[model samples]
Each structure stands twice: as structure tokens, then as C-alpha cells.
Target chain A: MAEQAFVTGKIETPVGTVPQVATGVSWRDRWGAFRVRLGFGRMRYTVEPGLYGVGAPRQDSPVLVTANYKLSFDHLRTALAGHDAWILVLDTSGINVWCAAGKGTFGTAPLSVQVAASRLAQLVGHRRLVVPQLGAPGIAAHAVKRQCGFSVVFGPVQARHLPEFLGRGMQATPAMRRKTFSLSERAVLVPVELVIACKWALPLAVVLSGISGLFGPAAFWENVREHGGWTMAGLGSGIVAGTVLTPLLLPVLPGRAFSLKGAVAGLMAGLAFLAVLLSRPGGAGNDFAVWAWLLLIPAIASFFGMEFTGASTYTSLSGVRKEMRIAVPLQVAATLCGMLLLFCARRLP
Target chain B: MRRRQLYLRGVATLRLEQDGCMGCGMCLAVCPQEVFVMAHGKARISEQDACMECGACMMNCPAGVIWVQSGVGCAQAVFHAMLGRGSEACCAIEEKPGGGSCC
Candidate 1:
């Protein structure tokens, strides 16, 4: 396969345009779907840690660094198109460079060893290494310099803008340094999350609806069916709210913490639920129904909204911690209250 | 505009040396920061400030030329580290906002 061919070669790193699995290979295996065979036919495309070529030049080219993840190698190699360069791959257990660097896999020791193993000093003409910006946290520049006899220069965050950055002579502007969660960026995450959730949510919804049908009044059974549909809709809305709307409304969201923003979105979702209740127009329904409606909907929405913060450019661990401390308990209590309300409503009329 | 340092005040930084760069431009292409640039047959650090320390560039460089420490930006990982659960890996759990565990 073309994907595997790229994986095997050292001189040319494939660009991002290539799919994970090339044409001709069974598409099902490449996607890692259709588990019916259970490892009967598995596909792999991860790059092994070692030396590589970047750009178009031969052995004497500049050496770039990255993890053994094929995609990461592909992106870096593909970006260099016309130039010849050396690539040093680290062992990050198939994780991407950013995360591996954070965890110290891309740090000093491996770099020093890879440099020695690759005999990089003998292969290249310079002693300066260009490093990515995101990896800065894990690397101790002074330590690396002492060990490798090379200084470290921190570069921009994105790869596409490299040509212009190079044209401008190694200077980064404020905009270049700032990370933006663009629409396309946000949209990419939806499929992965949706794929994961679709597996469990569907079966759970069916079970919950079946349980609701066995107890309570006709209204409760009706509510259960409606609840299943609403729950599914809520999940989809959560994706839209977090992935689509959050990025667009990021500046205007109510709180400093993403959870708070989600909570606000949840409040809006709660109002929608209220509208549903109002449409029924039943006098003297138990407060349980109202309480449940208020609590459950918002909690669901809030949960999804908060999850988006993990993927966004903004948001801090401590901020998330504080928000969780307050929000989780509140959500749990609200859900319990809603269930209680459902019980109280069942006892009435 | 009230801008307070919410949580990431003590974050980290990764630096590369241009003198050691072979102009592979590998870091230049993979970084989310647009930090590295190619110049005069070598890769240079065009921008140093935009890095979040994710370290993707360092891991993917084939020449073993990149070096950096990186971690996920999600709150769960940091929270775990703060709670002394530093070894656990936490990813984004789409529906459970603020809900992460030690494992």
C-alpha cells in the first residue's frame, strides 16, 4: 500500500494529502472497523523511531525531529517538498509529538541517543536544531545543549505557515504564536466523539425507555419515549454546542471556565425542555416533572459543553478543577432531584 | 476586559537550536504554533511565543534532532498531576465535562 510505502522509506516523508490506508488495502481494516474477525486481518502504519530525510536534499540536509507516529512523520516530510533534510524520529509509542514531548518521550535523553545513533553530527553541516513551540514545556534547553552540543530554537506552532515564516527570517509575530480553535479544527473532533458515543448511547436509551414503560402512568411512558429521542437530540446538540457554537461564541461565553460556558448553554437547553412541558398544558402536575425537566436537560448540556474545553486553545487545568468541584455535585444533585420529581408526579392524578 | 491568569501560569517551554538544525523543516511543518521556518537551507525558529508545549514536532523529527516536553492541554491531565495521579493518561471525555478519574 502507498501508506506502507511511505512508512518504509527514510528519504521521503509523505504529505498530509495521503489517507491513513492507501487504495487496494481493505478499507474496513484500515479504518479499524468491523471487529468481527478479531485480529484475523489487522493493518498498521506507524513509523519506527530512527533517522529520515526531510525536504528534497540528500544526506547533508537539515535534520528535523518528530515522533514515530506515521502521520506526524508524514506531515513534517510532506511539508518540506523541495528541500533535502534529515528527520530524527523518537519512540513515543505511536502517540503524536506534542503529547509525547509533554510526557518527556521527546525530551533530552532520547534526543541525545538518537543523535548519537543516527551519527547526526557526522551527517549534517550544523549544530543548531529547530524545535516546535508546543514541545518547549518538556525540554530543558540548557540541559539539551550540554548533552548534545547543540542549541535549541523554538519555532512556530503550525506547519503550513512555515514557508512564510522562513521567508521572514526566523521571527515569530504575536498572531503566529497564538493558538486559535478554528471552525475546521473544532469540526474534526465531532466525528471521533460521535463514533465513540454512538456505540453506548443507543443501547442505553433503549433500555431506559423499556424500564420507563414498565412503571408510572401513561404520561410517564410517553415521557420515556420522548426522553429517548430528546436524549439523542441532546447528545447531538451537545456536539454542535461544543464543536460548532462554542468556537464561534467563545469570546462571548459567560464565564472564564469552559464548564461555566457549558452551564450557560445547558441553561438554554433547559429552557427548551420547559417549552416542551408547557406544550402539554396539564394543570397541577407534580413539581417533580418541572424539577426533573430543569435539572436533567441543563446537566446534559453542561457536561457536553464542558468537555469541549479540553480540546480548545483556552482553558486551564486549575480552572477546570475548580469548575468540576462545583459543577459535578450540582449536576448529580439535580439529576437526583429530577428523578424524585418524576416519582412525585407519578403519584399524582 | 478582566484578564486573570486562570490556571496555566506555570506552564513549560521547549527550545531548539538553529545551529544544530539541518534545515529539515520537520518542526516547521508539524507545529501548531507556526514557530519554525526554513531559511538559507536551514530551519529557524520564526516564532517562540505561540507554543503551548505540546511537543509534537520533537517526537516526529526523523533525525532525532528535536527535543521538548509535551502533554495534552486538557484539564484532566493537569488535574491528575496536581492530585498526584501524574502517571495516568486522560483524554477528552465528550459528554462528561470535568469528570476524569485516576485511571
Candidate 2:
């Protein structure tokens, strides 16, 4: 409800009553955004594109432009806090401004169209539109100016520094322009990534657990308890290491490619798993079982890390492609080999 | 996250055509990697190593001297590319690693 309020507004623009912006966002909107980010109930998210008022703004307020992706919209308004401004949201089909800009949805056409659609010229006295720095790629400043008779000013990379940016005559300091991927930023993304990965990982885990049961000489339930649990545990650990821990420990983990970093974490996880088994009276199963994990766990972890290269700030498209070209085949082969060894371990006396 | 010292090199696909540079300083402003800097009033490639190939600089450059083989860095796109299946990944659902089709 509060989320909609931000998007749905009625304000007196020079163009006359237009859909204005909300004065504030509530805790409900923040929670909703968090839930959606976690891959929960995503369908309900989104707000209409148009001009919005942040606080109570007269015609002289600065008009900031952003995408209609609820998160981007929410973050922009949240950053404004006590300031009075006009937010002009372009319909990016629920994508964040940075991503949408790259996609061309947040490009010069949309900016120009939204300016016209929102009747922005009539609403604001100034001819300047402050756009997020990340959106610069999609916009041709000269083209926008030529088309709309308004100039584009690229603002700071992050929304939090908008106040300082606006206060300093719109001059962004060097630090404000830089984009950093912090732990919190990476951590917040884990839930959705993990959930997405699990769509495949869980089914594979069950299938492997069943395969592991075939090797055990014990009763069916006994096999399920031992081999199934162990197999599931192995897959679970790999998923956690690859998806969760890798991103958190990304900086500390060794390697330039995310795959290498993930493999390193997977190795650590596998070692810990081995340590637990070795602590038991008989140590961990036979060589097949032990070697099997060594081959599989890191493979899974490496695969996760490699997949994550897409999400990280550091990796390049060509770099990711290179990593996948080399690493993906190796990972698949290792996992297959590990599965074969597990088959051997199960069949052997 | 702290900036990594080295991402995968021998693969960045970034090229700067110095002849076309007019020192407009647009590239410097748009690059997140600090990949370019103005020297003698013309833009020069300072640290091509860290370039994530976001292409923001290239897109914003009025002189059009910058070139980067930009694409998404995520696995899903790679997954699609490798298999030649499943069009582009959903922008609404996926966090685009800039330079990919998701952008």
C-alpha cells in the first residue's frame, strides 16, 4: 500500500494535476521489497511511471529521474528523505535503473517520453534533469537536450549521497561517483541466487542420494539414513559454500575468477566435512567415498562461483565467458567422474 | 566488496582508439573501474586491467573512440549461449552483471 503511494500521487504541476510522488515510504514497503528480493511473491511488485512529489515541492524543485522498478523507486525516494523534489519514473518493466539503462529501456527515448508523458516541462521551472550516473549509458545527453530542450546531469552512482550531491551545486565528488560492491550488497543478493540455484541442486541431491543408497549393504532404511544423508549433506554443503559463503568471503578467497574463489571455499567445506568423518571411529568410508567428495564438492562450489561472476562487480563478460569456456567442461567432467567413483564405491565390497 | 586486484585478464576485450580521443572527459566520468583518465586534456586508457566492460564510457563518448565487447557476466546468459536455447534471461528477476544481454 505504502509502496503504491510513492508511485501514485496527485500534485499540481504546471501542466495541471498529474500523478505526483509520495511524501514518504513506510516500513511495509521496505519489507515488501526485501521479500521480493528474496524471490518471494515477485508478481505483486511494481509502481506506475510518471512524475511524483517527494515531500511538498513547488515548481522550482529539482526533478530526479529513475526507473519504475519498485526497488529503484523506493530507494530514490528513501534517499530524498527530508528534501523536496520531483521524481520522474520511467517504465522499465520492474527493473532497476542501472540494469534497465543497460537494457535500453531506461535510455534516451524513455527519458524523453516520460518527460512528455509526465508533462515535466510544465511542472518544473528548470530545464535540468538529474539522472543516476549508471543510467548514462542509455542516454545521449546531446540527443536528449536536442529532443526535449532539457539538459541531462549525471548524478552520483549511489542514491544515498543525493543530498550532498544536490547541495554541492550538483558536483559529485570522486568518491560519490565510484560504485563499490560491499559485503552487505553481496549478502543481500544471496537469497535470490541461492533460491534460483536450488531449483536444480535439490533434485540432483535426491537423485544422487538414491544412487548412494545403491552401494550400501545395509537395509533400505539404513541405507537411506547413511548414504542418503551423507549425499544430501555433501550437496547441501556445496550449495552453501558456493552460493552463500563464497560471496561473503569473496575478497578473502583466493583467485580472480569467481570459480576459483568458490573452489577454494568448497575445498575448505569438503575438508571440514572430512574432518568430521575422520573424527568418527572408522574414519570416513572407503577411498571411493572420500575421493568422491573431493571431486564433487569443489566442482559444485566452483560451478556456483562461476555462475556468480555474473552478479559480482568485478567480473567482465569476456572474463566470465573465458572462465566458463575453461572451467565449465572441467567441472562437468569432475562431477561425472566423482559420480562414477561413487558408483564404484557403492558396488565394491 | 573491495576492488579485486586482478579479474580475468587476456579476456577483457577493451580497446581505446587514441586517434579519435578529443579529451571530452566523458569516458572518465562514466567508467566505474577508473579505467580511463584525462592526460594532456585527452582521454587515455590508464588501467585497462580492471575494466568490467560496462560500456558506459563507450556509450557516453561523443567521439566514439572507446570499444568494449560488452555482455552480461552472469551464468544464465552463458548457459543460454552455450546451449543456444532459452532466449535472454529476465531482467526483472536477475541482477544484470553489466555488458550482458540482460542489460
Best by DockQ: 2
What TM-score does each of the candidates earn? 0.68, 0.92
Model 2 chain B worst lDDT window (10 residues) = B94-103
Candidate lDDT scores, in order, read 0.56, 0.78
lDDT of 1 by residue, A1-349 (tens): 2244543233432321111212122453335323211211111335667776543444344556776655556566666655555667887655555556656776778877777776767666678666656555455555677788876665566655555555576566545654666657555555543444444356855764654555546776686765545545544554455434554565577765565676676666666656765676562265666666666666655655565556566443444555677777776787678656655665465
- In order, what is each prediction's RMSD in angstroms? 9.1, 3.2
lDDT of 2 by residue, A1-349 (tens): 4445554556665677755555467788878877876766554466787777877788788989998778778888889988989888898877777667766888998899889887778777889999999887688776899889889888999999999999999998888877777889899878876876787788888777776666677776677787787788888888888999898998889878888899999999988887776787766568887898898899999998887776777677788777888888889998999888877777675
* DockQ of the two-chain complex in candidate 2: 0.44
Off by over 4 Å in 1: A1-3, A7-45, A196-204, A218-227, A230-244, A273-287, B1-73, B78-103
Interface CA root-mean-square deviation for model 2: 4.9
